[model samples]
Each structure stands twice: as C-alpha cells, then as structure tokens.
Target: RALAQRQARDERADAARLYGRIATAHTYAGRYGEAQRGWRAAAAGHRKNGDVAAAARALSELARVQEYAGRPEESLRTCQEAVEWAKRADDIRLQAALQLRLADTLEHLDDPEAARLHRAAAERILEEEPGDRDPEPEHGANACEIRSAPAEG
Candidate 1:
C-alpha cells in the first residue's frame, strides 16, 4: 500500500505494477470493490505509460473482478476491451487468454454458444503454437478458464 502511494506520487511505470499487486491482494482478501478500483488505477497507469499489454492485463483483471461482483455484462465488455488492446499490442498469448476470459463472461451471461466459440478460438491459438497443450484437462477441454500466475520479471 505504501509502495502504491509512493509510486502514485512519482507517476512512474512502477506505479502500475504496485497497483496490480495491491489489486491482487485485495482480491485475495475478498475486497472485490477495492480490487476493482485498484485494477482500474493500474490500467490507467499502464495506459499513461504507453504499455498497452499491461493495460490490457489490468483490464482483464478488472473484468474478473466485475465477474466476481456479479456483473457479467460489464465483465464481458471489459473483456472485449482487453481483447482489442491485446490485438493492438500484437500479443497473441494475451489475446487468447482474454478470449477465454470473455468466454467465461459469456457463459455467465447465458450465451453458451458464444462461450464455446471463444473457447474454440483460444484453443486454435494454442494449437497453432508448437509444443503447447492443455496443461490442465480438469479445467475442461480448453483449460482456458485456468488463471495462470503472473510471470516473474
């Protein structure tokens, strides 16, 4: 929290990272509202820093928070925005992950067919990559719903 305050004051890229951590902590602590706010801040910071990928990631996290808060429609919209950003950033992996998240949101919104389509799209992306397989079959045919831990820098 203190790191977030310091980073916010400095208005640096590190601020976005701190906000992401803070949001994750909030989510783990069951503070959905705070988590949403933190994710929004992180997204804004990433955008300001010209880091489209990070902004999309923050938006993805925001969508998850919205889903947790029972706002499937909002979550779906956020996921769409994240997808767009990922495409703009040319990050195929992130785009595929966001597509899966969108699929989950669509399922929550009672659009099973659309959800299935998204799962298929994500699967296709993974299949096109060499040596990539469904790491967790328990998560279903795509394992698209699995939340991967953030990569360490």
Candidate 2:
C-alpha cells in the first residue's frame, strides 16, 4: 500500500506494482469493479514507464475482471487492446496468449467465427515455437503473498 501512496504522489513504477497487488487481491475477493480500476491504473503506470508488455498484461487482467463484472463488450475491447500491445512488444508467446484471450472475449461477444480465427492464430503461433508453448509471466511473488500484505491506511 506504500506503493499506492507513492502512486498517489505520482510515482509510476511503484504505483504499477502496487496496483497489480491490489487488483489481485480484489479479484480473489470477487470485487470485480475495484479489480478493474486497479488494473486500469496499473496499465497506465506501465505505459508511463514504457513497459508495453506489462501494460498488456494489466489490460488482460482488466479484461478478465470486466468479464467477471458481466461487462462482456467492455472486456472484448480491452482484450483487443491487450492483443495490440502484445504485438507491439514482439513477444510471440505473449501475443498468442493474448490472441487466445481475445478469442474467449469474442466468444462472449457472440462472434463464433472471429473467436475461431483468433484461436487458430494462437495455435499457429504456438506451433512455430517448437516445443515451447504456454509461457507465463515471471512475477517474483505469488498472488496470495501480495494479498497478505497490509494495505496502507
């Protein structure tokens, strides 16, 4: 939560990590609106720091929280933005994961054909990686750890 205070003071990098922590906690607690807001803040912080990949990840989280909040159309747009950010980062594995996420959002949006195409694209990208597939981000600490930390009063 110290990070949040720092964020409030206009410290972007610390704000980004703290927001991620807060969002993860909110998600666990089923507070989707708060989670979405936290993640959106994190995305802004990441973008300010010139970390497009991190911004993409935050947007992906935001999309999921939006879905949980029963806002499928909003989630779909956020997922699409995440895909664009992943593409800009040139991380094929990340791009593929984002494409799969986009497919899920498209399915929720009632666009089966678009969802299928996105799924196929992700599959093709994975196939190009040989044995490498399903790469996840390497955050040092787990979500529970982040949640356990005391929030600043």
- Local accuracy by lDDT, each model: 0.81, 0.78
Query: Candidate 1 deviates by what RMSD?
Result: 6.5
Clashing pairs in 1: none
Per-candidate TM equals 0.80, 0.79
Where does model 1 exceed 4 Å of error?
A: 8-11, 128-153
Candidate 2 stretches with Cα past 4 Å from truth are: 8-11, 129-153
| Model 2 accuracy (lDDT, Cα) | 0.78
- Candidate 2 lDDT over 1-153, as tens digits, reads 598589579877887989989999999999888898899999998998999988988888888888878788988888889889988977677787778777877777779999899989987876786553334423322111001111124
Candidate 2 has a TM-score of 0.79
Cα error, residue 60 of model 2, in Å, equals 0.4
Could you give candidate 1's per-residue lDDT for residues 121-153 as a string of tens digits? 987876776665556534545333334233234
Colliding residue pairs in candidate 2: none
